[model samples]
Target: MRLRNIPGAKESLQQHPSIIIPNPSENKGNWKAVFGNDNPIHVEVGTGKGQFLIGMSKLHPNVNFIGIEKYDSVLVRALEQAKEEERPNLKFLNEDVEDILTFFEKAEIERIFINFTDPWPKNRHEKRRLTYKGFLDMYKQILVKNGEIHFKTDNQGLFEYSLESFSGYGMTLHHVSLDLHRSGMEGNVMTEYEQKFSRKGMRIYRCEAKFRA
Candidate 1:
Protein backbone atom coordinates (compact mmCIF):
# COMPACT_ATOMS: atom_id res chain seq x y z
CA MET A 1 0.00 0.00 0.00
CA ARG A 2 1.64 3.21 -1.23
CA LEU A 3 0.61 5.87 1.27
CA ARG A 4 0.70 9.54 0.37
CA ASN A 5 1.63 11.65 3.35
CA ILE A 6 -1.35 13.67 4.47
CA PRO A 7 -0.14 17.03 5.67
CA GLY A 8 -1.50 17.92 9.15
CA ALA A 9 -3.12 14.52 9.55
CA LYS A 10 -1.35 13.93 12.84
CA GLU A 11 -2.25 17.39 14.03
CA SER A 12 -5.89 16.81 13.17
CA LEU A 13 -5.98 13.53 15.06
CA GLN A 14 -4.41 15.12 18.12
CA GLN A 15 -7.00 17.86 18.11
CA HIS A 16 -9.84 15.33 18.48
CA PRO A 17 -9.10 14.13 21.97
CA SER A 18 -12.54 12.60 22.39
CA ILE A 19 -12.38 10.51 19.24
CA ILE A 20 -8.69 9.63 19.39
CA ILE A 21 -7.04 8.31 22.51
CA PRO A 22 -3.92 10.31 23.29
CA ASN A 23 -1.18 8.40 25.13
CA PRO A 24 -2.98 5.08 24.95
CA SER A 25 -0.23 3.38 26.95
CA GLU A 26 -1.16 5.33 30.06
CA ASN A 27 -4.73 3.98 30.01
CA LYS A 28 -3.62 0.40 29.35
CA GLY A 29 -5.65 -1.61 31.85
CA ASN A 30 -8.21 1.05 32.62
CA TRP A 31 -9.94 1.16 29.25
CA LYS A 32 -13.36 0.91 30.87
CA ALA A 33 -12.72 4.30 32.45
CA VAL A 34 -12.09 5.72 28.99
CA PHE A 35 -15.54 4.67 27.86
CA GLY A 36 -17.13 5.37 31.26
CA ASN A 37 -18.63 1.87 31.32
CA ASP A 38 -17.78 -1.77 31.83
CA ASN A 39 -19.20 -2.91 28.51
CA PRO A 40 -17.06 -5.46 26.71
CA ILE A 41 -14.37 -3.90 24.54
CA HIS A 42 -13.86 -5.09 20.99
CA VAL A 43 -10.96 -3.94 18.85
CA GLU A 44 -10.27 -3.94 15.15
CA VAL A 45 -6.57 -4.08 14.35
CA GLY A 46 -5.35 -2.46 11.12
CA THR A 47 -8.66 -0.67 10.79
CA GLY A 48 -8.00 0.91 7.40
CA LYS A 49 -10.34 3.89 6.81
CA GLY A 50 -12.48 2.69 9.83
CA GLN A 51 -15.45 1.40 7.84
CA PHE A 52 -15.84 -1.88 9.74
CA LEU A 53 -15.22 -0.36 13.18
CA ILE A 54 -17.63 2.46 12.58
CA GLY A 55 -20.34 0.13 11.35
CA MET A 56 -19.84 -2.27 14.24
CA SER A 57 -19.90 0.53 16.78
CA LYS A 58 -23.27 1.67 15.54
CA LEU A 59 -24.69 -1.81 15.28
CA HIS A 60 -23.53 -2.91 18.72
CA PRO A 61 -24.15 0.08 20.91
CA ASN A 62 -23.48 -1.76 24.15
CA VAL A 63 -19.99 -2.84 23.11
CA ASN A 64 -17.13 -0.38 23.01
CA PHE A 65 -15.24 -0.31 19.72
CA ILE A 66 -11.63 0.74 19.10
CA GLY A 67 -9.94 0.96 15.73
CA ILE A 68 -6.15 0.74 15.62
CA GLU A 69 -4.30 1.93 12.55
CA LYS A 70 -0.59 2.59 12.27
CA TYR A 71 -0.33 5.15 9.47
CA ASP A 72 -1.31 8.77 10.03
CA SER A 73 -2.44 9.25 6.45
CA VAL A 74 -4.78 6.23 6.48
CA LEU A 75 -5.91 6.85 10.06
CA VAL A 76 -6.87 10.40 9.21
CA ARG A 77 -9.40 9.13 6.71
CA ALA A 78 -11.04 7.01 9.42
CA LEU A 79 -11.02 9.94 11.81
CA GLU A 80 -12.75 12.11 9.23
CA GLN A 81 -15.49 9.56 8.70
CA ALA A 82 -16.02 9.01 12.42
CA LYS A 83 -16.32 12.74 13.05
CA GLU A 84 -19.62 12.80 11.20
CA GLU A 85 -21.24 10.48 13.73
CA GLU A 86 -21.95 10.91 17.43
CA ARG A 87 -20.79 7.50 18.62
CA PRO A 88 -19.85 7.54 22.27
CA ASN A 89 -18.67 3.93 22.18
CA LEU A 90 -16.29 4.37 19.26
CA LYS A 91 -12.65 5.49 19.48
CA PHE A 92 -9.54 5.38 17.27
CA LEU A 93 -5.92 4.55 18.05
CA ASN A 94 -3.03 5.62 15.88
CA GLU A 95 -0.43 3.06 16.89
CA ASP A 96 1.68 0.27 15.50
CA VAL A 97 0.61 -3.36 15.90
CA GLU A 98 4.02 -4.25 17.37
CA ASP A 99 3.31 -2.06 20.44
CA ILE A 100 -0.13 -3.57 20.99
CA LEU A 101 0.73 -5.12 24.36
CA THR A 102 1.73 -1.73 25.76
CA PHE A 103 -1.81 -0.39 25.26
CA PHE A 104 -3.80 -3.16 26.97
CA GLU A 105 -3.58 -5.41 29.99
CA LYS A 106 -4.37 -9.08 30.53
CA ALA A 107 -8.04 -9.93 29.98
CA GLU A 108 -8.65 -6.34 28.91
CA ILE A 109 -9.98 -7.01 25.43
CA GLU A 110 -12.93 -9.36 24.93
CA ARG A 111 -12.79 -9.70 21.16
CA ILE A 112 -10.50 -8.77 18.28
CA PHE A 113 -11.14 -8.26 14.60
CA ILE A 114 -8.52 -8.37 11.85
CA ASN A 115 -9.83 -7.18 8.51
CA PHE A 116 -7.79 -7.47 5.36
CA THR A 117 -4.39 -7.04 7.02
CA ASP A 118 -1.24 -6.93 4.86
CA PRO A 119 -0.21 -10.42 3.77
CA TRP A 120 3.57 -9.75 3.76
CA PRO A 121 3.80 -12.41 1.05
CA LYS A 122 7.53 -13.01 1.42
CA ASN A 123 8.53 -16.10 3.40
CA ARG A 124 11.10 -14.07 5.33
CA HIS A 125 8.33 -11.70 6.43
CA GLU A 126 6.09 -14.47 7.78
CA LYS A 127 6.56 -13.26 11.32
CA ARG A 128 5.30 -9.85 10.29
CA ARG A 129 1.96 -11.15 9.15
CA LEU A 130 -0.84 -10.17 11.53
CA THR A 131 -1.95 -13.82 11.87
CA TYR A 132 1.57 -15.05 12.58
CA LYS A 133 2.24 -16.87 15.84
CA GLY A 134 4.22 -13.94 17.20
CA PHE A 135 1.28 -11.61 16.74
CA LEU A 136 -1.16 -14.24 18.01
CA ASP A 137 0.89 -14.65 21.17
CA MET A 138 0.79 -10.91 21.67
CA TYR A 139 -2.97 -10.94 21.24
CA LYS A 140 -3.29 -13.74 23.77
CA GLN A 141 -1.62 -11.61 26.42
CA ILE A 142 -4.31 -8.92 26.39
CA LEU A 143 -7.34 -10.94 25.36
CA VAL A 144 -9.59 -12.49 27.97
CA LYS A 145 -9.67 -16.27 28.27
CA ASN A 146 -11.89 -17.57 25.47
CA GLY A 147 -11.57 -14.27 23.68
CA GLU A 148 -12.24 -14.64 19.97
CA ILE A 149 -10.46 -13.37 16.87
CA HIS A 150 -12.53 -12.71 13.79
CA PHE A 151 -10.44 -12.52 10.62
CA LYS A 152 -11.27 -11.99 6.97
CA THR A 153 -9.18 -11.54 3.86
CA ASP A 154 -9.25 -11.87 0.09
CA ASN A 155 -5.79 -13.45 -0.16
CA GLN A 156 -5.97 -17.24 -0.33
CA GLY A 157 -2.35 -17.75 0.67
CA LEU A 158 -2.75 -15.60 3.77
CA PHE A 159 -6.01 -17.34 4.63
CA GLU A 160 -4.45 -20.79 4.41
CA TYR A 161 -1.43 -19.67 6.36
CA SER A 162 -3.60 -18.09 9.05
CA LEU A 163 -5.73 -21.23 9.40
CA GLU A 164 -2.63 -23.24 10.19
CA SER A 165 -1.27 -20.57 12.48
CA PHE A 166 -4.48 -20.41 14.49
CA SER A 167 -4.84 -24.19 14.68
CA GLY A 168 -1.20 -24.64 15.66
CA TYR A 169 -1.73 -22.14 18.48
CA GLY A 170 -4.66 -24.24 19.80
CA MET A 171 -7.34 -21.83 18.70
CA THR A 172 -10.62 -23.56 17.92
CA LEU A 173 -11.86 -22.49 14.48
CA HIS A 174 -15.50 -21.98 13.50
CA HIS A 175 -17.51 -20.50 10.64
CA VAL A 176 -14.66 -20.89 8.18
CA SER A 177 -15.75 -19.49 4.85
CA LEU A 178 -13.73 -19.53 1.63
CA ASP A 179 -16.22 -17.32 -0.18
CA LEU A 180 -17.82 -15.16 2.47
CA HIS A 181 -20.16 -13.18 0.28
CA ARG A 182 -21.61 -16.29 -1.31
CA SER A 183 -21.73 -18.19 1.94
CA GLY A 184 -24.97 -16.47 2.96
CA MET A 185 -23.59 -15.61 6.33
CA GLU A 186 -25.74 -13.27 8.36
CA GLY A 187 -24.62 -10.16 10.21
CA ASN A 188 -21.55 -9.77 7.99
CA VAL A 189 -19.90 -6.38 8.18
CA MET A 190 -17.92 -5.34 5.14
CA THR A 191 -14.67 -3.47 5.37
CA GLU A 192 -13.38 -1.04 2.70
CA TYR A 193 -11.17 -3.68 1.11
CA GLU A 194 -13.77 -6.44 1.46
CA GLN A 195 -16.28 -4.42 -0.50
CA LYS A 196 -13.76 -3.49 -3.16
CA PHE A 197 -12.44 -7.01 -3.65
CA SER A 198 -15.84 -8.69 -3.60
CA ARG A 199 -17.04 -6.31 -6.33
CA LYS A 200 -14.19 -7.48 -8.54
CA GLY A 201 -15.24 -11.15 -8.15
CA MET A 202 -12.56 -11.91 -5.58
CA ARG A 203 -13.29 -14.55 -2.97
CA ILE A 204 -13.37 -13.45 0.65
CA TYR A 205 -12.23 -15.87 3.36
CA ARG A 206 -13.45 -15.52 6.93
CA CYS A 207 -13.00 -17.46 10.15
CA GLU A 208 -13.56 -17.18 13.89
CA ALA A 209 -10.90 -18.55 16.19
CA LYS A 210 -10.93 -18.70 19.97
CA PHE A 211 -8.05 -19.39 22.33
CA ARG A 212 -8.83 -22.40 24.53
CA ALA A 213 -7.38 -23.03 27.93
Candidate 2:
Protein backbone atom coordinates (compact mmCIF):
# COMPACT_ATOMS: atom_id res chain seq x y z
CA MET A 1 0.00 0.00 0.00
CA ARG A 2 1.28 3.39 -0.98
CA LEU A 3 1.40 5.92 1.85
CA ARG A 4 0.49 9.47 1.11
CA ASN A 5 3.32 11.85 1.75
CA ILE A 6 2.62 14.44 4.43
CA PRO A 7 3.93 17.86 3.61
CA GLY A 8 6.87 18.98 5.80
CA ALA A 9 6.89 15.70 7.73
CA LYS A 10 10.44 14.90 6.68
CA GLU A 11 11.60 18.37 7.56
CA SER A 12 9.90 18.20 10.96
CA LEU A 13 11.62 14.98 11.91
CA GLN A 14 15.03 16.38 10.99
CA GLN A 15 14.41 19.47 13.04
CA HIS A 16 13.90 17.47 16.26
CA PRO A 17 17.13 15.59 16.73
CA SER A 18 16.69 15.46 20.50
CA ILE A 19 13.35 13.71 20.25
CA ILE A 20 14.18 11.60 17.19
CA ILE A 21 17.69 10.28 17.12
CA PRO A 22 19.48 10.89 13.86
CA ASN A 23 21.42 7.92 12.43
CA PRO A 24 20.33 5.50 15.16
CA SER A 25 22.68 2.79 13.84
CA GLU A 26 25.65 4.84 15.00
CA ASN A 27 24.64 4.30 18.65
CA LYS A 28 24.33 0.51 18.12
CA GLY A 29 25.04 -1.38 21.36
CA ASN A 30 25.89 1.71 23.36
CA TRP A 31 22.36 3.03 23.68
CA LYS A 32 23.06 4.14 27.22
CA ALA A 33 25.33 6.85 25.90
CA VAL A 34 22.41 8.42 24.02
CA PHE A 35 20.38 8.85 27.17
CA GLY A 36 23.49 9.51 29.32
CA ASN A 37 22.50 6.80 31.82
CA ASP A 38 22.40 3.03 32.29
CA ASN A 39 18.68 2.66 32.76
CA PRO A 40 17.17 -0.42 31.12
CA ILE A 41 15.84 0.20 27.60
CA HIS A 42 12.29 -0.71 26.65
CA VAL A 43 11.27 -0.48 22.98
CA GLU A 44 7.84 -0.07 21.48
CA VAL A 45 7.70 -1.51 17.96
CA GLY A 46 5.29 0.10 15.50
CA THR A 47 4.61 3.07 17.74
CA GLY A 48 1.69 4.60 15.88
CA LYS A 49 1.45 8.29 16.82
CA GLY A 50 3.30 7.35 20.09
CA GLN A 51 0.40 7.61 22.54
CA PHE A 52 1.19 4.58 24.69
CA LEU A 53 4.97 4.97 24.58
CA ILE A 54 4.79 8.62 25.53
CA GLY A 55 2.43 7.83 28.40
CA MET A 56 4.69 5.03 29.60
CA SER A 57 7.73 7.25 29.44
CA LYS A 58 6.01 9.77 31.68
CA LEU A 59 4.86 7.07 34.08
CA HIS A 60 8.31 5.49 34.35
CA PRO A 61 11.06 8.06 34.34
CA ASN A 62 13.67 5.55 35.43
CA VAL A 63 13.27 3.30 32.39
CA ASN A 64 14.52 4.46 28.99
CA PHE A 65 12.06 4.15 26.10
CA ILE A 66 12.55 3.92 22.33
CA GLY A 67 9.66 4.15 19.92
CA ILE A 68 10.16 2.74 16.41
CA GLU A 69 7.97 3.91 13.56
CA LYS A 70 8.49 3.03 9.90
CA TYR A 71 7.46 6.32 8.31
CA ASP A 72 8.84 9.76 8.94
CA SER A 73 5.40 11.27 8.36
CA VAL A 74 3.79 9.21 11.09
CA LEU A 75 6.83 9.43 13.34
CA VAL A 76 6.72 13.20 13.24
CA ARG A 77 3.46 13.14 15.14
CA ALA A 78 5.12 11.14 17.89
CA LEU A 79 7.98 13.61 18.05
CA GLU A 80 5.45 16.44 18.36
CA GLN A 81 3.97 14.84 21.46
CA ALA A 82 7.38 14.00 22.89
CA LYS A 83 8.48 17.60 22.57
CA GLU A 84 5.59 18.80 24.71
CA GLU A 85 7.60 17.93 27.83
CA GLU A 86 11.14 17.28 28.95
CA ARG A 87 11.65 13.58 28.31
CA PRO A 88 15.33 12.89 28.61
CA ASN A 89 14.79 9.12 28.70
CA LEU A 90 12.43 9.03 25.72
CA LYS A 91 13.53 8.84 22.06
CA PHE A 92 12.06 7.98 18.69
CA LEU A 93 13.54 5.85 15.89
CA ASN A 94 12.45 6.51 12.35
CA GLU A 95 13.40 3.09 11.10
CA ASP A 96 12.06 -0.32 10.19
CA VAL A 97 11.92 -3.28 12.53
CA GLU A 98 13.51 -5.57 9.92
CA ASP A 99 16.76 -3.68 10.51
CA ILE A 100 16.41 -3.64 14.30
CA LEU A 101 19.51 -5.80 14.75
CA THR A 102 21.56 -3.06 13.10
CA PHE A 103 20.63 -0.56 15.80
CA PHE A 104 21.06 -2.80 18.87
CA GLU A 105 23.42 -5.64 19.74
CA LYS A 106 22.55 -8.99 21.26
CA ALA A 107 20.79 -8.77 24.65
CA GLU A 108 20.73 -4.99 24.47
CA ILE A 109 17.01 -4.51 25.08
CA GLU A 110 15.24 -5.07 28.39
CA ARG A 111 11.65 -5.25 27.13
CA ILE A 112 9.51 -4.80 24.00
CA PHE A 113 6.01 -3.48 23.43
CA ILE A 114 3.75 -4.46 20.53
CA ASN A 115 0.48 -2.54 20.71
CA PHE A 116 -2.41 -2.62 18.25
CA THR A 117 -0.33 -3.78 15.29
CA ASP A 118 -1.88 -4.93 12.04
CA PRO A 119 -3.27 -8.44 12.32
CA TRP A 120 -2.73 -9.43 8.67
CA PRO A 121 -5.62 -11.81 9.14
CA LYS A 122 -5.17 -13.57 5.81
CA ASN A 123 -3.43 -16.92 6.12
CA ARG A 124 -0.94 -16.12 3.39
CA HIS A 125 0.10 -12.98 5.28
CA GLU A 126 0.55 -14.82 8.55
CA LYS A 127 4.27 -14.28 8.46
CA ARG A 128 3.71 -10.54 8.25
CA ARG A 129 2.05 -10.52 11.64
CA LEU A 130 4.25 -9.07 14.39
CA THR A 131 3.76 -12.16 16.57
CA TYR A 132 4.92 -14.57 13.85
CA LYS A 133 7.79 -16.85 14.81
CA GLY A 134 10.31 -15.05 12.63
CA PHE A 135 9.62 -11.73 14.29
CA LEU A 136 9.66 -13.38 17.70
CA ASP A 137 13.08 -14.84 16.96
CA MET A 138 14.40 -11.42 16.03
CA TYR A 139 12.92 -10.04 19.26
CA LYS A 140 14.46 -12.82 21.34
CA GLN A 141 17.95 -12.18 20.03
CA ILE A 142 17.91 -8.53 21.03
CA LEU A 143 16.09 -8.94 24.36
CA VAL A 144 17.82 -9.57 27.67
CA LYS A 145 17.44 -12.92 29.41
CA ASN A 146 13.77 -13.43 30.35
CA GLY A 147 12.89 -10.14 28.68
CA GLU A 148 9.16 -9.69 28.28
CA ILE A 149 6.96 -8.77 25.30
CA HIS A 150 3.80 -6.86 26.21
CA PHE A 151 1.23 -7.07 23.44
CA LYS A 152 -2.28 -5.65 23.04
CA THR A 153 -4.64 -6.06 20.13
CA ASP A 154 -8.33 -5.79 19.22
CA ASN A 155 -8.37 -8.83 16.94
CA GLN A 156 -9.38 -12.16 18.41
CA GLY A 157 -7.88 -14.32 15.64
CA LEU A 158 -4.50 -12.63 15.94
CA PHE A 159 -4.54 -12.96 19.72
CA GLU A 160 -5.19 -16.70 19.51
CA TYR A 161 -2.62 -17.08 16.73
CA SER A 162 -0.04 -15.19 18.75
CA LEU A 163 -0.68 -17.32 21.84
CA GLU A 164 -0.01 -20.49 19.87
CA SER A 165 3.01 -19.00 18.16
CA PHE A 166 4.56 -17.90 21.46
CA SER A 167 4.03 -21.33 22.98
CA GLY A 168 5.46 -23.03 19.91
CA TYR A 169 8.50 -20.79 20.19
CA GLY A 170 8.98 -21.77 23.85
CA MET A 171 7.81 -18.45 25.25
CA THR A 172 5.91 -18.33 28.54
CA LEU A 173 2.74 -16.24 28.74
CA HIS A 174 1.42 -14.25 31.70
CA HIS A 175 -1.46 -11.85 32.44
CA VAL A 176 -3.41 -13.00 29.42
CA SER A 177 -6.62 -10.96 29.30
CA LEU A 178 -9.35 -11.55 26.73
CA ASP A 179 -11.00 -8.23 27.63
CA LEU A 180 -8.34 -5.86 28.82
CA HIS A 181 -10.36 -2.78 29.78
CA ARG A 182 -12.48 -4.58 32.36
CA SER A 183 -9.68 -6.90 33.44
CA GLY A 184 -8.62 -4.30 36.04
CA MET A 185 -5.01 -4.59 34.97
CA GLU A 186 -3.02 -1.78 36.50
CA GLY A 187 -0.57 0.50 34.64
CA ASN A 188 -2.43 -0.08 31.39
CA VAL A 189 -1.47 2.46 28.75
CA MET A 190 -3.80 2.87 25.84
CA THR A 191 -2.62 3.39 22.27
CA GLU A 192 -4.53 5.47 19.70
CA TYR A 193 -6.21 2.49 18.09
CA GLU A 194 -6.86 0.84 21.43
CA GLN A 195 -8.61 3.92 22.77
CA LYS A 196 -10.75 4.22 19.67
CA PHE A 197 -11.66 0.56 19.65
CA SER A 198 -12.41 0.31 23.34
CA ARG A 199 -14.67 3.34 23.19
CA LYS A 200 -16.77 1.46 20.66
CA GLY A 201 -17.13 -1.44 23.11
CA MET A 202 -14.74 -3.72 21.25
CA ARG A 203 -12.86 -6.36 23.18
CA ILE A 204 -9.14 -5.80 23.79
CA TYR A 205 -6.79 -8.75 24.30
CA ARG A 206 -3.44 -8.32 26.01
CA CYS A 207 -0.66 -10.64 27.14
CA GLU A 208 2.89 -10.60 28.36
CA ALA A 209 5.22 -13.25 26.97
CA LYS A 210 8.82 -14.04 27.87
CA PHE A 211 11.38 -15.98 25.90
CA ARG A 212 13.09 -18.97 27.43
CA ALA A 213 16.57 -18.49 28.79
Candidate 3:
Protein backbone atom coordinates (compact mmCIF):
# COMPACT_ATOMS: atom_id res chain seq x y z
CA MET A 1 0.00 0.00 0.00
CA ARG A 2 1.25 3.46 -0.91
CA LEU A 3 1.95 5.51 2.19
CA ARG A 4 0.69 8.87 0.95
CA ASN A 5 -2.71 7.45 0.03
CA ILE A 6 -3.29 5.66 3.29
CA PRO A 7 -6.88 6.64 4.11
CA GLY A 8 -7.48 8.88 7.10
CA ALA A 9 -3.79 9.03 7.87
CA LYS A 10 -3.71 12.80 7.80
CA GLU A 11 -6.64 13.08 10.15
CA SER A 12 -5.67 10.30 12.50
CA LEU A 13 -2.20 11.72 12.89
CA GLN A 14 -3.63 15.12 13.59
CA GLN A 15 -5.63 13.73 16.48
CA HIS A 16 -2.46 12.12 17.77
CA PRO A 17 -0.34 15.22 17.36
CA SER A 18 2.62 13.84 19.23
CA ILE A 19 3.08 10.87 16.91
CA ILE A 20 5.64 12.80 14.89
CA ILE A 21 8.38 14.81 16.53
CA PRO A 22 8.81 17.86 14.36
CA ASN A 23 11.84 19.47 16.01
CA PRO A 24 13.70 16.65 17.69
CA SER A 25 16.51 18.99 18.74
CA GLU A 26 14.17 21.09 20.80
CA ASN A 27 12.11 18.32 22.36
CA LYS A 28 14.38 15.33 22.89
CA GLY A 29 15.18 16.31 26.42
CA ASN A 30 11.53 16.05 27.47
CA TRP A 31 10.12 13.27 25.31
CA LYS A 32 8.46 11.39 28.13
CA ALA A 33 6.45 14.43 29.08
CA VAL A 34 5.40 14.83 25.47
CA PHE A 35 4.35 11.20 25.13
CA GLY A 36 2.33 11.61 28.33
CA ASN A 37 2.61 7.96 29.25
CA ASP A 38 4.70 5.99 31.68
CA ASN A 39 4.40 2.84 29.61
CA PRO A 40 7.70 1.21 28.74
CA ILE A 41 9.29 2.83 25.70
CA HIS A 42 11.05 0.84 23.00
CA VAL A 43 13.12 2.23 20.14
CA GLU A 44 13.68 0.73 16.70
CA VAL A 45 16.75 2.24 15.09
CA GLY A 46 16.95 2.12 11.30
CA THR A 47 13.27 1.30 11.05
CA GLY A 48 12.75 0.66 7.35
CA LYS A 49 9.47 0.52 5.49
CA GLY A 50 7.84 0.34 8.93
CA GLN A 51 7.01 -3.37 8.69
CA PHE A 52 8.63 -4.54 11.93
CA LEU A 53 7.57 -1.49 13.85
CA ILE A 54 4.00 -1.75 12.61
CA GLY A 55 3.83 -5.48 13.25
CA MET A 56 5.30 -5.17 16.72
CA SER A 57 3.03 -2.25 17.56
CA LYS A 58 0.04 -4.45 16.79
CA LEU A 59 1.44 -7.26 18.87
CA HIS A 60 2.40 -5.15 21.87
CA PRO A 61 -0.12 -2.43 22.50
CA ASN A 62 0.89 -1.58 26.01
CA VAL A 63 4.46 -0.71 25.13
CA ASN A 64 5.05 2.49 23.21
CA PHE A 65 7.20 2.48 20.06
CA ILE A 66 9.59 5.18 18.87
CA GLY A 67 10.84 4.59 15.35
CA ILE A 68 13.93 6.52 14.19
CA GLU A 69 14.71 6.82 10.53
CA LYS A 70 16.94 9.40 8.93
CA TYR A 71 15.15 9.42 5.64
CA ASP A 72 11.71 10.93 5.62
CA SER A 73 10.89 9.09 2.43
CA VAL A 74 11.09 5.84 4.36
CA LEU A 75 9.50 7.13 7.54
CA VAL A 76 6.30 8.25 5.83
CA ARG A 77 5.37 4.61 5.37
CA ALA A 78 5.71 3.99 9.11
CA LEU A 79 3.46 6.92 9.82
CA GLU A 80 0.90 5.55 7.40
CA GLN A 81 0.82 2.16 9.07
CA ALA A 82 0.47 3.69 12.49
CA LYS A 83 -2.52 5.66 11.27
CA GLU A 84 -4.12 2.65 9.57
CA GLU A 85 -3.80 0.64 12.75
CA GLU A 86 -4.76 3.67 14.83
CA ARG A 87 -1.82 2.66 16.93
CA PRO A 88 -2.00 5.26 19.62
CA ASN A 89 1.23 3.99 21.07
CA LEU A 90 3.58 4.65 18.14
CA LYS A 91 5.72 7.71 17.35
CA PHE A 92 8.49 8.51 14.87
CA LEU A 93 11.60 10.66 14.48
CA ASN A 94 13.16 11.51 11.15
CA GLU A 95 16.77 12.13 12.04
CA ASP A 96 20.16 10.56 12.27
CA VAL A 97 20.68 8.18 15.18
CA GLU A 98 23.80 10.07 16.23
CA ASP A 99 21.57 12.61 17.93
CA ILE A 100 19.21 10.00 19.31
CA LEU A 101 20.00 11.09 22.83
CA THR A 102 18.52 14.47 22.07
CA PHE A 103 15.12 12.98 21.37
CA PHE A 104 14.96 10.74 24.42
CA GLU A 105 15.36 11.67 28.07
CA LYS A 106 17.75 9.89 30.40
CA ALA A 107 16.43 6.51 31.49
CA GLU A 108 13.37 7.07 29.32
CA ILE A 109 13.72 3.95 27.21
CA GLU A 110 13.58 0.33 28.33
CA ARG A 111 14.61 -1.48 25.15
CA ILE A 112 16.18 -0.78 21.76
CA PHE A 113 16.06 -2.72 18.49
CA ILE A 114 18.78 -2.44 15.88
CA ASN A 115 17.64 -4.18 12.69
CA PHE A 116 19.61 -4.31 9.48
CA THR A 117 21.65 -1.21 10.21
CA ASP A 118 24.00 -0.08 7.47
CA PRO A 119 27.09 -2.27 7.42
CA TRP A 120 29.75 0.31 6.66
CA PRO A 121 31.95 -2.28 4.98
CA LYS A 122 35.26 -0.44 5.12
CA ASN A 123 37.96 -0.81 7.70
CA ARG A 124 37.87 2.92 8.37
CA HIS A 125 34.08 3.16 8.23
CA GLU A 126 33.63 0.67 11.04
CA LYS A 127 33.22 3.52 13.49
CA ARG A 128 30.13 4.69 11.62
CA ARG A 129 28.18 1.52 12.36
CA LEU A 130 25.42 2.05 14.89
CA THR A 131 26.70 -0.82 16.98
CA TYR A 132 29.95 1.07 17.50
CA LYS A 133 30.81 2.08 21.03
CA GLY A 134 29.91 5.72 20.40
CA PHE A 135 26.33 4.90 19.63
CA LEU A 136 26.02 2.22 22.31
CA ASP A 137 27.30 4.66 24.93
CA MET A 138 24.58 7.10 23.97
CA TYR A 139 22.01 4.33 24.33
CA LYS A 140 23.35 3.41 27.75
CA GLN A 141 22.54 6.85 29.08
CA ILE A 142 18.95 6.85 27.87
CA LEU A 143 18.19 3.29 28.89
CA VAL A 144 17.38 2.47 32.49
CA LYS A 145 19.20 -0.10 34.59
CA ASN A 146 19.39 -3.49 32.95
CA GLY A 147 17.66 -2.14 29.84
CA GLU A 148 18.42 -4.31 26.82
CA ILE A 149 19.41 -3.73 23.21
CA HIS A 150 18.17 -6.26 20.66
CA PHE A 151 20.15 -6.57 17.44
CA LYS A 152 19.40 -8.43 14.19
CA THR A 153 21.35 -8.39 10.99
CA ASP A 154 22.44 -10.47 8.02
CA ASN A 155 25.96 -9.03 7.79
CA GLN A 156 28.44 -11.45 9.35
CA GLY A 157 31.28 -9.03 10.02
CA LEU A 158 29.00 -6.45 11.54
CA PHE A 159 27.48 -9.06 13.79
CA GLU A 160 30.85 -10.27 14.96
CA TYR A 161 32.08 -6.75 15.55
CA SER A 162 28.94 -5.87 17.48
CA LEU A 163 29.46 -8.84 19.79
CA GLU A 164 32.97 -7.67 20.47
CA SER A 165 31.88 -4.10 21.03
CA PHE A 166 29.20 -5.19 23.47
CA SER A 167 31.63 -7.39 25.33
CA GLY A 168 34.29 -4.71 25.48
CA TYR A 169 31.75 -2.35 26.97
CA GLY A 170 30.83 -4.86 29.68
CA MET A 171 27.42 -5.72 28.23
CA THR A 172 25.83 -9.02 29.20
CA LEU A 173 24.76 -11.03 26.20
CA HIS A 174 21.70 -13.30 26.23
CA HIS A 175 19.57 -15.13 23.70
CA VAL A 176 22.38 -14.97 21.14
CA SER A 177 21.93 -16.81 17.85
CA LEU A 178 24.38 -17.07 14.98
CA ASP A 179 21.98 -18.33 12.35
CA LEU A 180 18.68 -17.10 13.68
CA HIS A 181 16.31 -18.67 11.16
CA ARG A 182 18.01 -22.03 11.52
CA SER A 183 18.54 -21.81 15.26
CA GLY A 184 15.06 -23.05 16.13
CA MET A 185 14.21 -19.67 17.55
CA GLU A 186 10.43 -19.45 17.92
CA GLY A 187 8.14 -16.43 17.95
CA ASN A 188 10.66 -14.41 15.97
CA VAL A 189 8.84 -11.68 14.12
CA MET A 190 10.08 -10.96 10.61
CA THR A 191 11.25 -7.50 9.62
CA GLU A 192 11.40 -6.37 6.01
CA TYR A 193 15.09 -7.17 5.77
CA GLU A 194 14.70 -10.48 7.57
CA GLN A 195 11.90 -11.56 5.26
CA LYS A 196 13.83 -10.68 2.11
CA PHE A 197 17.11 -12.25 3.20
CA SER A 198 15.53 -15.39 4.66
CA ARG A 199 13.53 -15.96 1.47
CA LYS A 200 16.81 -16.15 -0.42
CA GLY A 201 18.16 -18.67 2.13
CA MET A 202 20.50 -16.19 3.75
CA ARG A 203 21.34 -16.71 7.39
CA ILE A 204 20.48 -14.15 10.10
CA TYR A 205 22.18 -13.25 13.39
CA ARG A 206 20.52 -11.96 16.53
CA CYS A 207 21.35 -11.17 20.15
CA GLU A 208 20.10 -9.50 23.30
CA ALA A 209 22.60 -7.17 25.05
CA LYS A 210 22.13 -5.55 28.41
CA PHE A 211 24.14 -3.34 30.76
CA ARG A 212 25.26 -5.17 33.84
CA ALA A 213 23.67 -3.71 36.92
Give residue 49's error in model 3 in angstroms.
Answer: 1.2
TM agreement with the true structure for every prediction: 0.98, 0.97, 0.88
- Against the unseen true structure, what C-alpha lDDT does each candidate score? 0.94, 0.92, 0.83
Task: List the lowest-lDDT window of 10 residues for candidate 3.
Answer: 1-10
Report the Cα lDDT for candidate 3.
Answer: 0.83
**Who wins the TM-score comparison?**
1
Screening candidate 1 with a backbone cut-off below 3 angstroms (N, C-alpha, C), the clashing residue pairs are: none
Ranking of predictions according to lDDT: 1, 2, 3
Worst 10 residues of 1 by lDDT: 78-87
lDDT of 1 by residue, 56-120 (tens): 98889999999999899999999999999879999999999899999999999999999999999
lDDT of 1: 0.94
After superposing candidate 3 on the true structure, give the runs of residues whose Cα lies further than 4 Å from its correct spot. Answer: 1-17
For model 1, the stretches where C-alpha displacement exceeds 4 angstroms are none
TM-score of structure candidate 2? 0.97
Tens-digit lDDT track of model 2 for 1-213:
466678999889999888888899999999999999999999999997998988999899999999999898788888888888768989999999888888998999999999988899899998899999999989999999999999999999999999999999999999999999999998898999999999999999999999989
User: Relative to the unseen true structure, what is the C-alpha lDDT of residue 191 in candidate 1, on a scale of 0 to 100?
Assistant: 96
